[model samples]
Target chain A: MILTVTLNAALDITYKVAALTPHTTHRVGEVVERPGGKGINVARVLAALGHECVVTGFAGGATGAVLRGMLAPLAPHDALVEIAGTTRRTIAVTDGTSGDTTQLNEPGPTVLPEEWTAFLSSYDSLLRDADAVALCGSLPPGIHVGAYAELVRRARARQVPVLLDTSGEPLRRGIAARPDLVKPNADELAQLTGSREPLRATRDARRRGAHTVVASLGPDGLLATTPDGTWQAAPPEPVRGNPTGAGDSAVAGLLSGLVAGLSWPERLSRAVALSTATVLATAAGEFDAAAYERLLGRVTVVEHTQAASGK
Target chain B: MILTVTLNAALDITYKVAALTPHTTHRVGEVVERPGGKGINVARVLAALGHECVVTGFAGGATGAVLRGMLAPLAPHDALVEIAGTTRRTIAVTDGTSGDTTQLNEPGPTVLPEEWTAFLSSYDSLLRDADAVALCGSLPPGIHVGAYAELVRRARARQVPVLLDTSGEPLRRGIAARPDLVKPNADELAQLTGSREPLRATRDARRRGAHTVVASLGPDGLLATTPDGTWQAAPPEPVRGNPTGAGDSAVAGLLSGLVAGLSWPERLSRAVALSTATVLATAAGEFDAAAYERLLGRVTVVEHTQAASGK
Candidate 1:
């Protein structure tokens, strides 16, 4: 079973409006609500892909209850911890005519010290049966900057592979704990490496103690490097729709591939295919089996060699 | 006892952010949740002022549960009927620097026919003991434009004074039912009357079956035309601060004063005073008793003869 942690879960609300004009009242034509957060997104996609996954995180207040209820229909298993403050909501206002989206995210509720302790205590037991752990999204307020690092350390102690996906200070701090894999988008990679070049940034991320670095370049496809091999995987064609949770979908694909004992090239191909399929799906981070199967054959994986491949 | 009906109740969520940029994600500094709808806002303020009020409406799903939980702390009685769909949420993002607010309102869940029947049945029983009833806010989807008209007719059957506050078609349809009172802001009044002139529009509103028309003009204060007289009540001085729910607060004040057997002038003065105090207070729709007491003495009530009121 895969264990996913979303420190800052949200109730994702999509509102369809004729148009959005600043400082004016708008009557929404449609509203759709779902569970949200990078980890939650990853877990949702994994469940849709027929994977066994357990989601554990801090949920609180009324918004948290709504978030959990939304998750009930999507995820396979739930072990979310109850906290004091309510979870936040992220609003996506889409223009019905133009299809352009304006997103407003609420900063999730703060996590107190005792809540963190409770989560870690419960997570230790959850990790014992988990094949891999994925720590995803931004940490809520009051959590230590190195909170993900502690999770990575715990995963290592349990001898379970861990995937880290986040940005900024938390990502930087979590990398030093040497998670099995870290996936950062182009901009996050640049911030970490202080370089615009993807190849250089990927290498820099690996040098920061990540065993493997997967750099997701939107539309351009996925770039990954490991101690044994380096590869670039690209879909034959770009599929366009909503790219909101494409990265999380890719993380789900990669974890599913790893658990299936697929080769690195096959894993990269699966990740690229699933991410592309997610974009083509009606909702973000959700890929139907038919879409995934249709896109699988079109993904092309190319191998690259490092100067010091053995290291 | 006062009965307030919020056909489309919502879980009002507020997020305090440093600033809001369209399409960008933000971490909220603070979060607050309250039960919201115009009538719920009125009920909260009335309850805070120590009035016996019963809140009734259609509530459903997890979001509805959250709304009810939040309302539990504010209202004296609850007669919410369970519906098929969850309640909606309204998000207010406040910019910490300039204090400018950006609002995003969700289109509330559709009220099924069974839910409407349930609510009307419950409302019928509650109306038996109600001295006054307030029909407020927009009609939720799936309900007819004349839903409030039916509610007003029911309230009138019990000889209860009904205050109808809504906008556009609902307000237009509701007025034909001959509600005792109708309160519209400047914009809603103009839309209903097709006249931009406040006095003319308010008088026009009164001519269309409403015994009394009260128009709230924000900083311009309250304008009312009853059978006894036409009066414009303004605060002695402009009280400046947040005006988020000053109109609803005024409605609460008017109802509270009327229930206490105050005269029209006294009710109008108290409405203006409470509204001014609410604007002066830090929280939306909340007025400090001391500030309200001080402002009451400073409200200026000006009487206008119908002949002179014609522009």
Candidate 2:
């Protein structure tokens, strides 16, 4: 079973309105809510792919209670820690006419020292049974920046394959623990290595202690610099829709491949195909199964050494 | 004791950010949530003034659960009915720099036929001990348009004074029930009686079956046409801040005075003073006691028939 951790989980709420005007009132046409955070989204995609996944995170107050209840049916196990502060809610107001979205994110519940310790204890027990672990999303307030690094170290000690997906200081610190794989989008890679060139940034990220670096190039696809060698995976065409959970879907693809012992090229193909399919899906973290099946055989994975091999 | 009925209650959420721009992302700096709806706000103000208030409405789902828990400490009694649909959340994004607010309100939970019948049963029992009843806010979906009118009739059968506060067709139909009092803001009154003139609209509303019609004139206070005579109450100055709950505060002031058996001029004075103080207060549904006390003595209630009496 894959274990996923979301430090700052949220009750994601989307409001549909006719139009959004500043300083005016709106009568929202519809409201949709779901459990959201990087790890939760990844777990959802993985579960859809027929993987048994355990989700652990901090959930508190009324919003947390609602999120916990929603997660029960989506994931196999719930290992969320209870805390004092209320879990935050993230809202997206979408304009029905234009499809323009306005987002407002709340800083999540602050973690106390004892709460962090309690979570660490829970993590230690969950990792014993986890075949692989994915640590995702931002570090909540009051959690040390090295929280992910400690998690990576604990997973490594158990000899479990761990994937770190985060940005800024936490990502930088987590990389130092040398996780098996790290997925960073273009901007995050550039911010970490200060190189606008994707190839150079991915290489530099790998040199920082990550065993393998997979850089997501948005609509283009996934680029990986791993022990097997460099490979670039691209879809047949660009897909357009809400790109919110595309990266999480890609991470699920890569993790599933890792556990199944697929070649790096095949894994990159699956990641690119799944990410594109997620963009085409109606909601975030959900991919059309038929679309995924059709696109899987069409994805082109070219090894850097082999001059542009076609599918 | 005043009984306030909020057929559509909500969990009001406020997000404070630097600015709100369409199609962009905002990291909200602060979040504040409270139980809200027209009657809930009025009951909170009444409770603040040391009045025993009972609140009843439809509160269900997760948002409703959160609202119910929050209302426990604010209002003395809770007679809210449980329903299948979740109560809605209203969001106000306040720009910290410009102090401008953009609001998005969700259409509240739809009440089933059985739910409406259940609420009426609860309302009938609560009215037995209520000194007066205030029916407030919009009718949720599936509820009949004449909900307030039905409530007014029931209160009248008990010989209890009822104040109907709503707008559009609901207000029009409710006035025919001859509620003892109806408070309509200038726009609501204009829509009901097709008159922009405050005095004419108030009189027209009273003639349509209401025993008393009080029209809120924004910063100018209230104009009332009642059996005693015509009176206009004006505050010393226009109190300015967030005017979100000013009208609810006025309703609380009026209901408090009616139950205490105050004279018409005194009731008008209290209503004007409390409404102005609410505007000056920092948050919605909260009034400064010191400000209310100081404004009360300065509020001038002029009897129109007395040939324009001045302070």
Candidate 3:
């Protein structure tokens, strides 16, 4: 079973309205709520792909309880560490007429020192029975920047292949622990390496201690530099819809392929197909099975043989 | 003890931000949540005024549980009837720079037939010990528009003074049951009586079976046409701030004065002072005690002996 950790989980709420105008009253037409965070999203996608997954992280207060309750039916194993602060809610107000979305994100619950220690022990236990582990999302308050770095160290100690997906200082620090894989979006990659070019940034990220680096280029698709070789994967056509959970779906695809011992080309194909399918689906963290099946065989994967040569 | 019934209770959530722009993401600076609805707000204010208040109505689901948990410390009596459907949340996004608030209100939970019956029985038991009953807010779906009307009749049967606070069809139907008092703002009054003038509309509302009709005129204060006499109450100066719970505070002030057996002018003075003070306070349903005291002696209450000549 794959273990996913979400340091900052959220109760994702969506409000549908006719239009959103500042300082005006809106009668929301509908409310949709789901458990959300990078790891949870990945776990959801993995579960949909018939993979056994366990989710562990912080869950607290009323909103946390609601999130856990909602996650029960979706995820099989729940190993969340309870905290004192109430979990945060992320609201997205969608305009029905224009399809515009306004997002409001709360900073999420602050973790105490004991809560962090508690989580470390719980995560260690979960790692013992796990084939692979994923450390995802932002580090909550009171957690040091090296929190993911420490988790990566523990996973490496257990010889468990771990994937780290985060940005900024956490990403920089965690890479030092040499995680098996790190997936950063183009923007995150630029912010970390100060390079506008994706290939240069991916190589820089890999040199910082990531064994493999995958840079997501939005509609342009995935660019990966791994031990075997460098490869690029693109969809047949650009898919358009809510792209909220597309990245997490891609991570799930890569993780699934890695566990199944698929070739690099096959892994990239699955990742691109799943990512595109997720964008084509209605809700975040959900992909249409038919779309995934159809797109799987059509994804274009090309291997790049040219060395970086310090470019 | 005063019994306040919130047929449609809510978890009032306030999000503070630097500014509000459509279709953009906002990092909320702060979050404040409280149990809210017309009756719940009234009950909160009443509790602050040293009145023993019991809050009853549907409280269910995760949001309802959170509301009850928050209300536990503020309110002494919780006679809320449990339901199956989850409660609603009303989000107010306040722009700190402009001091403007954008509101998004979710339609409350649909009350099942069995839930309505359960609430009616609970209301009956509470009314036995209540000096006054306040039926407040809109009727949730699955409940009849005449829900408030039925509550008014029950209150009348128990010889408990009932205050009906709602709008549109429910208010119109509820007033037909001859509630002891009905407080309608300028817009609600206009909709109810089809009259533009406040005095004419107040008289029309009274004629429609409310024993007492009080028309809230926003910054202009209140115009009351009671069985004892007609009076106009205005604040010393127009108070300005958040006016979210000003009406509920006025309801609390009126109820307090009635229980204290104060004269109509004194009651009007208290209502005006409390309403103005609530606007001056930082949060809804809470009045600045010092401000209320200072404003109390300065509010102007004039007896209007000239009856409306069908204007």
Candidate 4:
């Protein structure tokens, strides 16, 4: 079973309108609601991939209740902790005319001291039955900065392979705990390493204590530096669609492949394919299955023989 | 006791931001949630006015639960019918920089046939114990176009004075049922009477079947045509703020004043004062008590010397 942790979950709502104009009233033509957070999104994709996954997180208030109800049927196991504060919500107003979207994110609730303690205990207990764990998204208010680092350390202590997907200080502190995998996009990589060059940034990330660092280069695909070797993977063609959850789909692909004992190249191919499929899907946090299957074989993974062959 | 019906109750959510830009992402600084619908807003003000108000309508799903929870301590009584469909939410994005607001209103939930029957039964039962009833807002889908009209007839059959506040076909049909009172703003009045002139339009609306008609004239205050006579009541000066629920506040004042056995001039003074106070309040569906008191004495009410005087 796979384990996923999301400290800050959201009820993702999308409102479709003819157009969005500032200071004007718009009657929404359609409303779409779903549960979202990086880890929750990853778990959704992983479940679609035929993996047994358990989702652990904090959920409270009306928004949280709606999210939990929606997630009940999606995830195999739910280990969400109850909190006193309300969960946040994100509204994506999509204009039907220009196919543009405006995002409004509510600030997450503050986690109480006992709530964080309770979450830590639950996460530790959930890790006992997990094959691999993925820690995803930003930390909600009142949570420690080194929260990911502590989780990564705990997962390692339990001999569980963990993947960390976050940015800024969380990613920096998390990598120092030496997680098995870390996937950071170019902007996050540049923020962490202060290097505009993808290759240099990717290598510098791995040296920061991450066992393996996969830097997502947006349209250019992914550059991965690992103990075995360095590899570059790219989709045959860029898929044009909503890119909101493409990275989470990539994390799902990589995490699922690791649990299935797929090689680094195979994982990279699957990750790139799933990400492109997610981009092709019309709705956010969903992948085009047919596209994923078709692109899986079309994805190209090449080994970089110039990099250090520590293996 | 006052019975107010909001067939399409909503969970009104407001998001505060520094600025609003279309097709751009924003982080909301704060969120404020409340129960809203025309009648619900009226009930809120009536409850604040020390009236025993029983609110009845349809409420369902998670949004309904949240709305009911927020309204439990608000209204004197909760008699909202349960339904299968989820209640809708209205989002108001307030831009702090320009003091502008962008509104996004979700279409109300469709009322099931059985649910409509249930509401009618509950409303009839509640009206038996009521001095007056208010049938408010747009009819949700699946409800007959004459929904308000039917409700008005029922209230009249029980000798319960009913005030209807709606627009378009609903207002046209509801007025023909001879509701005790109908409050239509300038636009609704014009649509119903096909007359641009306020005095002529207000009189025309009364001839169509409403016992009395009160036309809200924006900054021009209110024009009332009733059995006693016609009168114009205006605030001393224009009190500027959000006008979202100003009319609903007027409806509350009118109903409450009628139940308190106030004279026409006194009722008009209270209505105009409450409406002005609602505008003075920073938040919607709220009246400034101090301003209401101050403005109550300052409001001017003069009876029209030449008008329909059958009374």
True contacts kept of each: 0.50, 0.94, 0.92, 0.93
How close is chain A of candidate 1 to the true chain A, as a TM-score? 0.97
Ranking by lDDT: 4, 2, 3, 1
Q: Candidate 3, residue B51: CA error in Å?
A: 1.3
lDDT of 4 at A162: 97
For residues A1-311, could you state the per-residue lDDT of candidate 3 as single tens digits? Answer: 99999999999999999999999999999999999889999998898898999999899999999999998877557788999998889999999998889999998888999999989888888888888899999888789999999999999999999999999999999999999999999989999999979888899999999999999899999999998888889999987898888899899999999888999889889999999999989876689889999999999998887654343
Query: Candidate 3 lDDT, tens digit per residue, B106-200?
Result: 99898999888888888899999998888888888888998889999999999999998899999999999999999999999999999989998
How far is A195's C-alpha from truth in model 1 (Å)? 2.3
TM-score of chain B of 4: 0.97
Docking class of 3: high
List the pairs of residues colliding in candidate 3.
Answer: none
lDDT of 4 at B306: 66
Compared with the true structure, all predictions reach lDDT values of: 0.87, 0.91, 0.91, 0.91
Tell how far residue B53 is off in model 2, in angstroms: 0.9
Please, what are the lDDT tens digits per residue for candidate 1 over residues B58-130?
Answer: 8888879888877776655878888888788787778899887877787888888988988888999998899
TM-score of chain B of each: 0.97, 0.97, 0.97, 0.97
TM-score of 3: 0.97
lDDT tens digits, residues B1-311, model 2? Answer: 78999999999999999999999999999999999899999998999889999999899998999998998876557888999999988999999998899999999998999999999999998999999999999989989998999999999999889999999999999999999999999999999999998887888898899999988888989998888899999999766787889999999999999998999999999999999998888886688789999999899898887455221
Off by over 4 Å in 2: A306-311, B306-311
Report per-candidate TM-score of chain A alone. 0.97, 0.97, 0.97, 0.97
Clashes of each: 1, 0, 0, 0
Residue range A102-186, candidate 2, lDDT tens digits: 9999989899999999999999999999989999989889899999999999999999999999999999999999999999999
**Candidate 4 on B1-311: residue-level lDDT in tens?**
99998999999999999998888899999999999898899988999989989888889999999998998877558899999999999999999887788999999898899999988888888988999999899888889999999999999998999999999999999999999999999999999999988888999999999999999998888999998789999999867688889999999999999999999889989999999999999787689999999999999998887635332
Off by over 4 Å in 1: A306-311
DockQ of all predictions against the true structure, Cα-based: 0.51, 0.88, 0.90, 0.84
